[model samples]
Target: MRRFFAIGLLAIHLFNIAGYSLVFQYFIYQTDTNLITKLDLNQYRESELIQFKIPISVPYIADRPDYERVDGQVEIKGVLYTYVKRKIERDTIYLQCLPNRVTQRLSKARNAYTKHVNDLPQSKKNQTGSTIKKSGIFSEYDFKTLDYQFAAPLATASTYISYLSPSPVPGALEVPGKPPENRG
Candidate 1:
């Protein structure tokens, strides 16, 4: 009877440790890293829907949106990530993300174009008596029309979720109330 009781206690302790480890890993991945989940397109088919739990810090957790296709972006560590909010269950947010490279490239190009356009007038001022240049061939409205015509036929972009490891610094759990803890 004594040996059986000792074995039962050990089993209970081991199960407790296993449960705590699972919860700790889940918390670390959700809050400390940019990873949506451990699962990715490589592990499943492109058409299959992958659901993951999100931290409560995410917006619209209480007031769920009526539309299924809500788009949102979050900036983590100065990098912007674009994702579509497909469904929401309490704090869990199910969504698909756009590749970081594509979004980053588009953002950079937009900034460069804006800078170039802003400087165009200054450069024109320096050139005296130069022949007047014609306006761009396509007007703003023309581009909108073109987009409407081609938007549906274009293929939807597929993306693979990328992961970023947590920083080496100690988190709040490791050092409570410490000034050196990284809040970002």
Candidate 2:
């Protein structure tokens, strides 16, 4: 009787372990499938929309008074604004219309550009005048245009840069207050 009871208890414990393992695996699989489904949905939504292809090439410049120029080809539907560069590579995409928030930001950038231009000495301004004219960085209407040029001195113009779609930063959704609950 004692031997039978011991064996029965051992068997029950083994069975419990097996059951727990199967449940845990199912939970993990469900979580993975949920994540994959969410990603697929997001991709489908983005692919269904139209986006403009804009090529941008920004040069790296050291500290200097010279205005760094960015050159790019901006494509809006069939309209194309081409620029001269060693190579043209499509870098970003934009929607047909600008968001209200983006418009506000662009206005701020325009103001900053005006201030910078006003501060420039006459000689430096003269040298950059033609490039700026050709580049159209200071044009009020041009700045409002959805497309942009890739030029040198990109660091200063980082704020003005916009992406076709805002990418979610990795690990951004993690709970900051606590680690995940351990089922074990």
Candidate 3:
């Protein structure tokens, strides 16, 4: 009897663990999350920056986003994010995000970069070079006057006009004693 009781207790415990595991899995699947880790952006290589495009219902933020200046913590569907600049086009959304603490460092780097660029001496725009005027036969020809328009087939224009025209109303024209043609 004791052995049976022990087996029963073990079975109960196993079932409880399984139930909890299933519930946790469900919770994870239901949650909408974006994990912004340090590997997302490399300060040395600007091209390696990670961009997240999420399709969700959000208010129109901006058409052209200035990611550097925009600073805020956004809570999107219960998920918290920092330094995320959003651009919503139609139904889709583009998210540019950076880690919370890294924002200051990025700003500092940007300032230093701009200062360094400004300090550099400006190079002379026009450099004198030896030039030889060409006297080729083709040089006298006026290439701009030549027509480059594509010569489309006459049938294509007719087909396009037909497509643009409104479709005929069904049964709009009925002949006497003839079963109405199903134009549709």
Model 3: how far is 31 from its true place, Å? 29
- What is the lDDT of every predicted structure here? 0.50, 0.42, 0.47
Index of the highest-lDDT prediction: 1
| Candidate 3, 1-184: lDDT as tens digits | 9999999999888755454444544443332122233223433234433466877665654544434423345545534445435565666666665434333344334334433434532332234543223232345466676667887678644333323435476436555796778988
Candidate 2 lDDT by residue in tens digits, 6-122? 999998886554544445446545544553454345423433333344444555423233322223334344333222212233443232221223223333444354445446332
Backbone atom clashes (below 3 Å) for every candidate: 0, 6, 0
Which residue pairs show backbone clashes in model 2? Answer: 59-152, 69-151, 69-152, 70-150, 70-151, 71-150
What is model 2's C-alpha RMSD? 33.7
Better of 2 and 3 by lDDT: 3
Rate residue 28 of model 1 by lDDT: 42
lDDT, model 3, position 80: 42
Q: Which stretches of candidate 1 lie over 4 Å from their true place?
A: 1-52, 57-67, 109-184
Candidate 3 Cα deviation (angstroms), residue 162? 73
